[model samples]
Target: MPHLNGVTVHPDCRHFRGDIPCRPNKEYGYQCQDCPVYAPTQQRILIIKLGAIGDVIRTTPLLRRLRQEYPNARITWLTLTPAILPQSGGWIDEVLKLELTSVLHLQQREFDLLFNLDKDKEACALLGSIRAHQKFGYQLHPQYGVAWPVGELANHKYLTGVFDELSQQNQKPYVQEIFELCGYEFQHEEYVFDTHDDKGYDWSQLPQGRPRIGLNTGCGDRWTTRLWSDEKWITLINQLQQAGYAPVLLGGEAEAERNQRLHAATGAAYLGTFPLPQFINLMHQMDGIVTQVTMAMHISIALRKPTILMNNIFNPYEFDLYGRGQIVQPDKQCVCFYRGSCKLGPTSCMEDLSAEKVFEAVRVSVPLA
Candidate 1:
């Protein structure tokens, strides 16, 4: 009998890189496949999702499913926002940031399966060049050719971005479609938001006996029209206070100045900016969150906080709030779906979606019981 059990230890060894061995320390003083003292490698899987932060957070529904399907697989996730890795608990064994060194390291080894969800050219190109036993999601752009979404699951996601009509007609929420890409059922899968941060927030400073509502000021630069006018936010702030809710201001460095103005104008508690981890911890205090289709909205949904989503340009159906929140849209039918700017010019569709309607959505009796 061989010195080993003749069983491949791919799930317990360090050198095993799919079929390519990366032996180091001269442990066996020979190639791994030829060695008798081989320790098997854990089932290796790689998940690639570079960020806009929101996308990074939402992609986590795959974690529970991936764990169920490949229980012993040592998973490695690649992303730009390294902060989220800790938040994922130990679901992922390794967190590789997008960089030249990380790229080279990935290319050096082969994965049992590599799932690249990013549509960005760089990610697709890397997916094309990497040596994986199997790849799902988008793949490389052939020489001078455009990158293509690989499977039937990605076809709808791919076309939605390529054409106007497809996106308008797309009824699938991003989470459901992405789950399908990984060969899993939607079944109301939720996002994982537990970070390593154990910081505690003092909610004592907030006004008593009032619904603590968060008003996120910025909608990000991608879609300027997605943002309600400053006057509109101010209007909502006044309305929120009148309705006996304590409106707290939430935003990033970009919105600090804007939030400050809103804060001063409305006398709302301005919880100044903190790091992402601390910020996430602070969000727990909110009874509800009001924002456009932004990262704050994703965070609130993950926390299962009552979120009042303000949508104008994108399909409201694309968001799966898990039955925890209400989606408020403009009374006007969006003419420019998935578009950055509106065809209606100065008269934005949002103007018709009045502050009163959004306020109604924000005050939903209580946070879903």
Candidate 2:
């Protein structure tokens, strides 16, 4: 008798597959539910997607597909941040914070399958070291030179990132590309909001009125070229108020001062700021989101709220809004496509976008009621 996960693997069982725990061989009349390895040696799955919040949130759709593929498996996730994905939700059994010790400890375990979708060097390097019966997505070279896709299905995604021309030419949506890398069909899968981040609030009390629209001002620090100017936001807010919609300012502490200025300038309610969880909940109170591409945009889409998304740096085709929103780009063509930095110096391409374009888009996307 050989033991794995402290369960005996019967020598006579036909489900023995080299070095792995034995499974039930129905043809041999050996049922796994009746066997010693049933409980302790059940399928174990691991997922590694560490974050910048928005990426982690967008990646939540995989939980559904992974569960569909491995119903019996108890899934464990490794992430840099905690609580972005559900640990209490029925789908995920555990979430291990990414640390050296945690990685080394996880390395000791045997998994039936593993999925690593993060393009980070750290994640790719770890994926290369992990032991799994099967692995999908990118892997760092053994010498840790660079990350590359582990499967041919991921080749397109890999090539797109490796070559700027390919990225510009690629027409596949970001979500679809990621799903293909995992050998899973996209099927128009949507993200699940199991994040325990909700602090909850009374929606009736928070500036209730016709067509409450959130003006998300910040777009993170990585892509400066992607951000629309504060002048543009102020102009849009002023226009929105005149158009009979209550525009509320939305952003982290980074935009607190800017929100104050916008609020004072336009009387657009500065509903004030909250932590990430509370902010997300506040976003739920809004009827529509008018935002530059950011984490709020991801939340809005996840909640299925209609939006007028502004995009300039990235290609419009990269975003799949699931028909719940419309993308409004500047009148002028962007010189910085996929490049986080601007090529036009002080005169940004997003400056070409007018308040009328966004206002009209918002009106059409979520008509004021």
Candidate 3:
């Protein structure tokens, strides 16, 4: 009913922004009244999954199902790591970082559907505060002052999160669990990632005529229990090189010194770590990947590269590699389940998982050229 200049403004349009000029208008100088690319927002959906970068990346599979279910929905994702999320032409219409400003803005809006995947108190609290016609996943219980599942569908995932034994017994992959929580069945939906191919990054330093294997050396600082020894990595590098595959070292700034040492020791291709987007592009160049249950593993899976996931602490069933990778565990069962530090003091099950075992898994899993 209201006019901006000569054209009537449609607030329900997906591209309509009250504060700034809409994208369609800015790009094509088109008014809201007769805009050709006017996509009306049907439902407003909020997804609250503020967690680790890897967790954020893995949660992307739900977008596929959401788009199919709500084709005209204006989806907004709230996360701690916004950069990890796919930007343009992706499922999410808006990506908001978890902060006071974002919280204030979110509190002002009402959604048709709200899904708070994280069980954290802050996340649950936000879920309780947000106005939505239908709510799913966890929410903060006002009386108990704790996070509780919204419905029976979320009970399984909630129980697993609380109890280690139940989590270990869970045969369902993460995608299936999330789908069930949202009242849908899992259908092998793939991760939606922006590979950043248009960046034009030159990766010619890696030798040609050989399959490039990315060796993600770090398991992040939080989970030191998942870390493999440097000696074992060196051995794996040598094994890869001998097998006619180019071994490339991949890690974040935390693993820079170790990666440098490994590179110097084994003459492996080590293009020092770049930013998140550039690092993703670097992983894209790899034919296969060998990594602990870290961000690299998620990135490799999203890229659809054949991967050898060296795991011990977490449940193997939790990860869905989309039939592109194999999970290799240690011969000795890990005493510390879901722990940051090894309960067995000096001895670790990771030592039991030898370089030869990993190399063999790589050879079998990765289709070498």
Give the candidate number with the greatest lDDT.
3
Off by over 4 Å in 1: 1-42, 195-197, 201-204, 365-369
Q: For model 1, how does the per-residue alpha-carbon lDDT over 1-369 read when each residue is reduced to its tens digit?
A: 123576434335544454454454245455545466554535779999996899988998888888778776878889999786553355777788999999998898888988989888888988888888888888765765676888786777778778878877889899888887766788876787773246665657766677788888788888877878778888888988887788899888999999998888889898789888777766777888898899998888888888889998888878988877689888878887777788878667887788888888876734332
Clashes of each: 11, 0, 0
Candidates in order have lDDT scores of: 0.79, 0.79, 0.91
Give the per-residue lDDT of model 3 (tens digit) for 264-304. 99999998979999999999999999999999999999999
Q: If both were scored by TM-score, which would come out higher, candidate 1 or candidate 3?
A: 3
Worst ten in a row by lDDT for model 2? 10-19
Task: Judge candidate 3 at residue 112 and give its lDDT.
Answer: 99
Model 2, 235-268: lDDT tens per residue?
Answer: 8887888888888889988888888988888788
Q: Candidate 3 — which pairs collide?
A: none
Cα misplacement distance, residue 27 of candidate 3 (Å)? 1.1
Clashes of 1: 11
